[model samples]
Target chain A: MTVTLAIDCMGGDHGPSVTIPAALHFLRADRKARIILVGRTEAIEPHLGTALAEFGERLRVHRASEVVGMDEPPAQAMRSKKDSSMRVAVDLVKSGDAQAAVSAGNTGALMAISRFVLKTLPGIDRPAICSTLPTLRGQTHVLDLGANVDCSPEHLLQFAIMGAMLVAAVEHNERPSVGLLNIGEEEIKGNETVKQAGELLRKSGLNFYGNVEGNDIYKGTVDVVVCDGFVGNVALKTSEGLAQMLATFLREQFSRNWMTKLAAIFAMSALKGFKHKVDSRRYNGASLLGLRGVVVKSHGSADAFAFEQAIWRAAEAARNRLIERITERMERERSAA
Target chain B: MTVTLAIDCMGGDHGPSVTIPAALHFLRADRKARIILVGRTEAIEPHLGTALAEFGERLRVHRASEVVGMDEPPAQAMRSKKDSSMRVAVDLVKSGDAQAAVSAGNTGALMAISRFVLKTLPGIDRPAICSTLPTLRGQTHVLDLGANVDCSPEHLLQFAIMGAMLVAAVEHNERPSVGLLNIGEEEIKGNETVKQAGELLRKSGLNFYGNVEGNDIYKGTVDVVVCDGFVGNVALKTSEGLAQMLATFLREQFSRNWMTKLAAIFAMSALKGFKHKVDSRRYNGASLLGLRGVVVKSHGSADAFAFEQAIWRAAEAARNRLIERITERMERERSAA
Candidate 1:
């Protein structure tokens, strides 16, 4: 079975320069995948050059008449730029021409367009932006990264169900546990929705791990950590900020004195090992989970390497039929929510 | 005039075992500081052994008849445990026997009793938990760490005002800038409260630096970062988790191989310097700001060194008269909110 992905070729900071190379890289690596490059032919063609002959029929281009600005608001972008590369790419997924859609464009615009085009899964109130964070044990899939700002108890439960399905499908964790993100691990902690979610999650058949605090995300104690988008976004961004700060501090420390600089040279391999453990680019792909179809969001500023990673992620989701898995799980459980 | 602090010696995990030593450590470091140990005298007396003579009149114990268990519900603790060491300690601040109160007790209980006893500063709707986070520049004061879970736009503006004043008073940073924490820096981003708060913050007389993402907290782009309690708590805890994870990973790397162990030995001083730079103890004290009187919250499981840091923080806040500064600033600037 061919897992075809629609690439939003004319979005984000680097546009075709990154997406074209990414699409080619993904196609070359995955023999069972195909990509439809959706953008202005002239802009995309300059970069596609030998990739067309190399990939043969596996890769093709679809012309899009308009482009969505990176800063454009989601609702306005969805309404005005109906023929934009972002919209066209999502449309391919809706039309069954592609199994998934991948974009490095305006996050809000992509979400809005995709939701409008693909619609939400049955029994899902709001689709969450789920992403992977590197943890001490391995990796954690945290949901509601910023797609929905305000969520109710029902929304949180749906997120857990969807998140569990995503993990079980992609990561192949047979009994992946879900943790409710709270200030403390106790059942009594957290706000109203969190408390209510705890109660509902306890009753659910899924492997529910009572309640986990913020540190649990990095600890990798659970496969899925659930929260409202507002808290999730703050946590994700806070970690990103701290990571960057630590990196900067380490660099400054290494250069502080000649002796320290010499020590850094001696410890290069060890430092690289640490860097690889927390590398930002390694966790760049964010799944726009809960959409009726598979859609992966690449970081807006992702370079070729990161964009390629996102494409691979999209292919993986398509291969796993992640949307079906989520729908099936939601249908089986949490239908009452 | 001596600045007196009321210590809830029977509060935290180790109770007097931690708080007594912390208070003594604090007293030894600063001769001018006085402490009214507010707990059952019998519980605190054993730990105050030889150091009691060195401090003499500056160190004394006050009798409190009740204790609030760490896991007790906040509302219940507030109502039933009026004579708790936590309550009596706060009462000392109210009656002017002490200028400040320090407790490593239950956070919810502390906030509840502090708000009930000290009340909110004039023009402030809610009291917020503000703490310092080490950044590249120095430190950032982030507010609403776990106070008001649900906040209005006006409440956010008020937080910014109170946070700005707290920074100005405690850090002695004149014209300190305030950043509204958001998912993104764009004016159009974030939920309704955030958007509304951004508009109000732009007009706020305080040095507003526009919307700052989570990374800005560690970047020290602004002296104060304001958010509703839910986001702030998650951000703070998430950072804690990440910091711990990083420390663990570094330790593992150092011990992974004999060669890396040799490299670690060579880089011992530099590594220690880096550890001290981000040490959790250095950022231990959390100021429960926007109260009628100064209250500093120590981490529940804080060791003697960390609890001492909290005591010093409370002393500094009292000496600076943080309440008057916040009251005056809020009256002058954010009365409309």
Candidate 2:
């Protein structure tokens, strides 16, 4: 079976300078995968070179006359940049031409375009951005990374259900424990929204694990951690900032003195392996759950290696039939209700 | 002009095992500083051996009959355990017997006890907790770390002002630019609360630097970064978790093989220095801002070294007249309005 991935070729900062090379790398690496590069032909052609000829019929281009700027407002971009690369890529997934769509563009624009073009699954109220974090125990999925910042209790309940479904389908957890991120672990400890959400989650009967504090994210106490976009975004970004800071600090420390330099040489292999394990780019892409079709958003600053990882991730999502599982779970939920 | 700090002798996990020894260390280190140990007399006397004779007059004790358990709710603890060490420490600050107070007890209980005793500073709606983070550039102050979880735009503006005052007084930033923590750097980005806060901050005539993203926290883009307690707490904890994870990953990598262990020896000095710089315990104390008196909350898990750092932080805050500066700033704002 040929798995076609629709690429938003003109997304991100460096555009085709990064995306074109990344697409070619994916195509060369995976024989079972086909690439549908969606963007302006002129912009993508120069970067394609002779590598584009090697793929032959497996590779194709869909010209998108318009491109959305990273700084453009989401609503304005959606209205004005109707034929933008992001829209074209999402449309391909919508029209069944591609099994999945990938973009490293303005996250808001990608989400908006995906939502408008692909539509939400039957019972999913809002589409959530779910990403896996390497924790002390293993890995945990955190949802609504920045989909809906001002989420209500109902929205949170929906996020919890969707996040659990995704974790169950992709992570193969039989009954994934869901935790609501709160200031304190106790039921009585959060703001009004959390209080209401806690009640709703309890009633939802979705393997609710009660409230988890900020520190619990690394502990991996639960399979799914649910929160509004505002809190989730802050948590995600803070983790990213701290990781970057630590890596930079280590580099500086290793170069500070002769002893440290010697230590660095002795620990070079270990350090490299450690860096490889924790590299954000290695896990650069996140699945946009609740969409009718499989859609993944690669990190904005993803390099070719990171982009390649994203391709693998997209393949995994497709192979797992994540959307089908979610639909089935929603249908079951409806019937149970 | 003897500066006295009321130490909560019966607080923290180890209680007097850590606090008494720490107080003795502080007393021996600084002759000009007076230490007022507030707790049960029987509990503190055993920890002070020879040091008691050397500073008999300088080291005083205030008898507090009750103890607040770490598990008790904040309100319940404050109401029922009026004579708790935390409350007694705050009472000393309020009564003018001490220049400041320090505690490692329940954070919520301390906040409530301090507010109940010292009262909020004029024109301040609520108190905020500000802590210093060691960044590459220097230390940065993040306000409302866990004070008010759900804050309004006006409350955030007040937090920004208080944070700026703190940076100026404590960090010595002459005109520290304050940044509103948001999902993106764009002024138009973030949720409704951030949007409203941005508008108010721009017109408040403060040295506002506009919206700052999560990645910019450690980059030292602004001297003071202000946000609601929920976001701030998540950011603080997430940064901590990431730092710990990175440290763990590095340790595991360095010890995995013999070659790496040899390299680790060479990198020991630089790595130790880096650890020293980023260690939270080295900067463990948090100031309870917007209160009429200075109160620094140390981490409950602090050791002797961390406690010493907290003592130094308290003395520095006292010497800098942080409370006085905040009071003056608030008065100026009122008069200007």
Candidate 3:
């Protein structure tokens, strides 16, 4: 399948310097893919150099005059930054010029813009931010990272269906198990919303794994873990905080004294291997599930290699017809109901 | 002032094998402290051996005929296991025989029994689970870890006051800064409850630090972080899961080959130092705040040393009059209103 992705070339910390290079790398890696670079012509062109010549019609730029600040408020950005690169990227998907959109901009702004432009699927109440985390058994996809803070039980059930569909499309697992993220695995645990959501999921005709705890996400106990945005966001950020603290601790220990420093030298190769396995860069892309079109959000601080992975994820999702799958599944549910 | 702690000897996975030894170690360490070991006499006697003789009247055992199972339901344990060791431990604290209670038991059972026996302090609706976590600056006290899953703005405000008092007592910090845990630091972020809680905390007269994200917990941005128990518990367990995954990845990396094995040998000391710094056992005790009597919950899987740390925490809180401090704070708030 031929996949076309609109790249938000002016988003993220490094802007065109990182995004343009990543778009070029992604174009090279995926032979059946095309990219529309959306940003200021002057800024994005400088980084594209000879890639345009080599790829010909496969790569091009779509000029956008404005850029959204990393910390800009979502509503303000949505109202004012109409010509922003992030907006134009999502617009390209809406305009049917691209099958998917990718951005490494302000998460709240990206979600706001994407939801505004692309809208939600027919049966989806809200779009959820879904992302993968490294697990001992592989990886698990968790949804509602920080989109909707206060979600109803129906929203959680929708999130579960959307997450499961995304995993099925991206990971090619037809019957990916869905787990309701709760404090305990028992049925009696959690608040009223979660308890009601659990009941909804058990009858949702999906491969439900009942309720799972926070540790189950890393244990890879289920393929897709569904939660309200508030809890999911806290869990994701808490993991980020802890991983950073442990890394800092390890670095301090290795550099403490002469003997430890020498030990770090000898352990360099193993440490590098260990670092590669747990690198957050590998898990850069976060899928904005439940949207009408594929929209993947990259980490704000991602480097070129990491940003390319985001593009790759968007491409994979588009190629696998993620939106169509979710649409069809929702349609089936509605028809059955 | 002499502080007496009631230890639940037949609780936890190892029962008296872990709790009795921990109690003896605690008795030896605290010259001004006494312990009442509550459990079946037959099971508790063998572990006491020479410790009771050595410590004289400072250590003594109070026999309880029944034991609460680790996986027993909280309500069942409270209703049926009236004479369980865990119940006897809280009973001693309730009767003023001991100033505090320490238990390595089912958290729900401990909390239920403690609340049932001693009751909540005046003006406090529910007790909170407050625990210290290792942070970059030093340590941060966070609540409510797993006590009240669904908390209102008022309940969260109570938690802030209770957590701040716990810090003031144990850490000897008269004015500890408190942060409301939210998805974002902006004033307009989070659910209605959190936004309302932020407003209440701002006017709470405590050292409120506005809103903080999950990462702020480990950054030591504030001395105390207060959140609804559901969010706090998920964050805590998510951290545990990520840490476990990273550790497993590191072990696998170091044992991959002969060359890596050599590197592991060289890096052993540095690794040990790093491990010791982030050891969960060092931060074992969780204070059950807002109760009339001090009660600390140890990890159910704690060893002798870790369980002793829980006892030490109970002793410190009792010595520092944690309950009285909270009670006085609540009284002042109520009077001010």
RMSD of each: 2.4, 2.0, 0.9
Say which prediction, candidate 1 or candidate 2, comes out ahead on TM-score: 2
Q: Which 10 successive residues of model 3 chain A have the least lDDT summed? A: A328-337
lDDT of 2 by residue, B178-259 (tens): 9999987887678898999999889876799999888778877888999999888878877776667677888898888787
Ranking by TM-score: 3, 2, 1
lDDT of 3 at B154: 96
Task: Name the regions of candidate 3 deviating beyond 4 angstroms.
Answer: none
* DockQ per candidate: 0.70, 0.68, 0.87
Model 1 per-residue lDDT tens digits across residues B1-337: 4799999998888999999988998898898999999999888888988876888889889999899998899999999988999999999999999999999999999999999998987778888899989998999999988787778988998888878887777789879999999988889778899999999889878899999988889988999999988888889889988999998888888788998899888787778778888888888989998888999999999999999999988998888878888878877784554
lDDT of 3 by residue, A136-208 (tens): 9999999999998999989999998899899999899999999999999999999999999999898887899
Candidate with maximal TM-score: 3
Over 4 Å off, model 1 = A203-205, A334-337, B79-83, B199-204, B333-337
Pairs of residues clashing in candidate 2: A259-B266, A260-B266, A260-B267, A263-B263, A263-B266, A263-B267, A266-B263, A267-B263
Best by lDDT: 3
lDDT of 3 by residue, B1-337 (tens): 6989999998888999999888887777779899999999999998878988899999888989999999999999999999999999999999999999999999999999999999999999999999899998889999999889899999999999999999999899999999999998888899999999998888778999999999999988999999999999999998888889888989998999999999999999999999999999999999999899999999999999999999999988999989889989998877876
**Best-performing candidate as measured by DockQ:** 3
In order of lDDT, best first, we have 3, 1, 2
Which docking band does candidate 1 fall into?
A: medium
Which residue ranges in model 2 land beyond 4 Å of their true spot?
A: A46-56, A334-337
Q: Single out the weakest 10-residue window by summed lDDT for candidate 2 chain A.
A: A328-337
